[model samples]
Target: MASKCGLLLFVATIQVLIVAAAVFNGIRSGYTKVPTGQFNSNIDQILLGQNSIERILWDDFQKTPELTAFFVTENPVKTIANGAFQRTPKLERLGLRGCQLTGFPNLVYVHGSLIELHMSNNLITKFTREDVHGFTKLQMLDLSRNPIASFPDMRYILPSLKTFNMQGIGFNCCLPLYQLKHPVLVIDAAPCAYPDHITDRLCLLESRFRKFRWNHRLEIKAGYSSSLGGTACQEGIFGPTCSH
Candidate 1:
């Protein structure tokens, strides 16, 4: 009886390891070429995970030199294109939390004066050290709600970071989060927010579909995916930002 129990336990452990590896491999697949992004030359930024061409929005925004803060309420800003700062070089605060972003925005910087960046509540899944390495003066960053499998060492990358919020985040697998100081990152904290799989296999699915959008008409949670099947996934689809 003891031998049989041990054999079962070992098998379970192996299966768990296999899934974990797949999750990491998928997320790291985009890093094969060591992106010569902000880390190389006079660079600083990201964009929707897999999106390539830069899309612009709000043409009038190009002349707001005095605008200290940029925010969108119910409108839901999808991408913060490079033109967003063509005229305004000194943005002190940016609020994109709870918006519709599946990946990081490749930002071009004229100055690193941005002090507070609110990016929690979006569907951002992939993040790395280079993402924020250029935020030389960034003081606070909010990355909550997005189901990130694991966080890379953020100790020194953000030199001026005083507070980091990652509440309501996702996990690759089950986590013993009782020891976590920021209980807000708990997947079960909110009801009907993200689908059950978000908390179950967050990492495994994070990199699966890099380009996706939210269909407001559908009765589904904001970050929920339609591919999983159910009445809430009518528009499990995404293409160019304008295709919506």
Candidate 2:
């Protein structure tokens, strides 16, 4: 009788241990299957392409606080739904080049930590003053190869902007070149002249445009000038009308 009781007690203990092990394994599996919302809450940077991205289903990203950088480039078939990143708080750098975007997406409500923005090679035609008002900390902006015809009011630019690239675009007149404030390193104002205008007058002045070298100052080549007679002009014309 004593031996049977001892055997029964040992079996019960072993069964309890097995049950405990099974319960722990179940908990581990459940944790592993937690949704991405809880898993990616602390993600700082995300690079997503069209194949893996469904903008409509990703509307839950507004809750994430640590998200700082985002690179979004979608295919022609995939459209980025509006309001996709309206509420991301810590977002800083955004690159959306070659995304086939027609108009500017609404990003006015994002937090003010944004520093770098690259939106080159798009089809953007218009930009309001208020579209870029909230980006106080913006340092770099690339609007190359777009269809913007003119610059908005000077006050629309962020005060802390360091580098601004608007090359390969169209500008109506020389108004933007004269209005832009200091610290503008490059302006690519080559396209600011009309067909009939004096190319030298429209050319960016070498005095106004300076090139810096290490421990030395470099002389920038001035645009061409056209003389009344057949004699070669003072400086060659710099606009499209000038003969190469």
Candidate 3:
């Protein structure tokens, strides 16, 4: 009986030691090397290469309060487990570009300190307003080269968003400009190859013009009156006359 009790205590000690080692490794991993391009003191650039499991070891991150930015691209995580960021309330920037994610992880929703999110070249189909409801400080979001057809109202929800990349989404006819509050410098608007492929997209603009709402009408009228140019509309040029 005495030996059994001693063995139990030894086993518990080993478990505690293992946990402590994991936490130490996770925190010390960031100090190995600094990432290239864009450095901020407020952000903690972490390169997670050893993590094979779906969840980020939140238990390790919680110990380091100063840690902010998470750069998990070197060894890109395939799937993020839920509650992965529960302890990481201070994390701001997250770079999961080319992680091969089909959907935004549940862990992302819990953190509110997120300001910049890089999710380019993922398998994400669409992002609704509710999916990103809590990220009030989000400024930069990259959703390039996804199958996203429907988009959330960017103007209403992500008011602070400055750079929005929807390059290869393949907008069929027209983009929903009515959903935007301010005129953002939208990249790759002519995904359908406007003017070049007239048959496919020539009448596309006309169809959008016919279905213009009150806000769209006001924008069109304002553009026509402005010194910028005539035949101006949200989807770049109004027709062949307005094509830049």
Candidate 4:
């Protein structure tokens, strides 16, 4: 009996070790080659991982000013450093999955050009309306598998956003998605505790807006902004200097 028990234990330990080795090898095989000195000049898109030699190389970015897409996954990018993307003005698509980043990097320079942002499997907690208001042309946003608890009104901010992915984040309140006129595909409906209240508010808001002119309808929250017949003008959705 004792020999049989020992044999079973040894087999389980061997299985665990085999799984761990396989995972390690898989990660190693998935690494994309970082551009070398001469290879950096004309590259428009690059896949990066922890072993990327150019991770901290600023000159590489300067050489590739027209870089449009950047993907960094299955690794931890400790610091993106200020002005890292200052020269990549044409950057449109950015993916930072599994980068261990706590928040977004400073991409103020690329705000106007960025269209798709994928930050899945990071440690992000929140994304206020103001955080994304500047990306007017932004179309797709994937924040799946993050730790975000709540997000502000998406309609008032990302009016042009088409694909919004919030799967794997556990939210407790209903998102005000009615304000978005553009066709948007929302993934993962929020699991709210007060379903009745949320449903009633959405119903009332939608019904109230149906009576008003489309141009006159502004997204609003209670006691948050100046109301035209109890409908407050949505904030932070305007262009620079609130021109829009």
Candidate 5:
């Protein structure tokens, strides 16, 4: 009876060891090479055993050629940290809607390949010329619901920009019409109000009038006063001085 009991205990110990080995092997097999392809369906396969991605290193994953579009809905990835997607040359579309980003990142490196950028519902307050300068191929830029205050320069516009939505973004100052280089298909500058009386038309008129007086003064200095029709001596109408 004693021998039978010892034998049974020995069998049970072997079974436990075998089960443990199998479980360990299964776990190791589950972490095998992740495939790469265009539009990788296994992108979110590795959850890092957590609900959100705390960190993402491309080198750790297999590369997929079809990964042109990336949609990040995870709240923990609110702001795209610097160098997050810096080396992805083939990336074309990036959607970060509802991310709590406080401002726009310097994406001049990705401007060459990025076509559509959706950053709506963010906390961006400003856009510098260098921020959008290299995106010559960009088509759609959604900056709606932000806190942008001004358009610093017009040189940042890409030739392919078709849709620009700036609605709900506060620009407490005058909207510069000259900032638009190409004909925009749609612009949601609706909520923006003209804070002053100087519309584009008024500014143009003022500029042209100043240029005319400057030319008149140059002509007068060149002995062409006959064009003044003897009114050059009129009070407060001196050459170029009338520009004031």
Candidate 6:
């Protein structure tokens, strides 16, 4: 009988998974929990870390133009209105780390598909050149551990910048950081820690706030708030309360 029908089809007697199939019915599909600190995702990235989100208006989120990364780290965010990602035309990474911003918000003159613009540990103090005249395709610009001392004209609006992290920004060691009498060397390498001791990784010049007596004109200066939407940190002192 053809070897007993090939041993009864390998003892199955008919040939198959012995008729006890269950390719994937092990069941465990019921997930829906993402509410603390906020979440509105399906992968296009929008972290919203530690949210108490002060402001980013424009209906917060859901204008996805295939949104491409937009975090609000350690949120207490002070401002960010003007088309807050304005239907994210493929926003290429834009985080506001440890918020309570003081300047340079309005999504950097209308996101030009930013390629990483962290705004490190907020409470920012400066940023000029018409506030980054449209970031001309920015490429990694993390104003490390803010309290910044105004910068812009990065070769005139980041003409495709390639990493400019002002580590713990503190340049005004007596206002010489800029005086343009033909003094062009603001970022041929962009790495700082000038006046007071600063740190946020390597540029650290030994500073535990160096014994807190540094008001060298507010080290990174930005008490200049005539309120055009910037500066905020008194009300239980928001996040990044002058970050370290």
Candidate with the greatest TM-score versus the true structure: 3
State every prediction's TM-score relative to the real structure.
0.47, 0.58, 0.59, 0.59, 0.53, 0.27
Clashing pairs in 3: 44-69
Question: What's model 1's overall lDDT?
Answer: 0.48
Give the Å error, residue 144, model 1. Answer: 0.4
Over 1-244, each residue of candidate 4 has an lDDT whose tens digit, in order, gives 9999999999999988754442112224344334434334445676564443324334446767757877767666645666767788888988777766676666676789899998888888767776776888899988888887667657657667888877676554433433332245353433342333332112122422321122122233322322234443232332101111
**Model 6 lDDT at residue 219:** 24
Which clashing pairs does model 6 show?
Answer: 102-231
lDDT of 2 by residue, 15-99 (tens): 8875444211112122212123542455666554333332332364665567677665442313444566665777888877655
Q: After superposition, how far is residue 183 of candidate 6 from its true place, in Å?
A: 15
lDDT of 5 by residue, 185-230 (tens): 2334334444533232211224322112111222212122324333
Q: Rank the candidates by TM-score, best first.
A: 3, 4, 2, 5, 1, 6
* Model 5 TM-score (2 dp): 0.53
lDDT of each: 0.48, 0.53, 0.54, 0.57, 0.49, 0.52
Clashes of each: 11, 6, 1, 0, 2, 1
Writing each residue's lDDT as its tens digit, candidate 3 over 1-244 gives 9999999999999988754443222322443332222232333445554333233443445444445667655344556657566766777787776656778667564447888888877788868887777777888888887777657657667767787777666554344444432454354524542223332121223553422212112332223322222333433433222332
Of 3 and 4, the candidate ahead on lDDT is: 4
- Measured on C-alpha atoms, candidate 4 has an lDDT of 0.57
Model 4 stretches with alpha carbons more than 4 Å out: 1-38, 49-60, 174-185, 193-244
Query: Model 3, residue 28: displacement in angstroms?
Result: 15
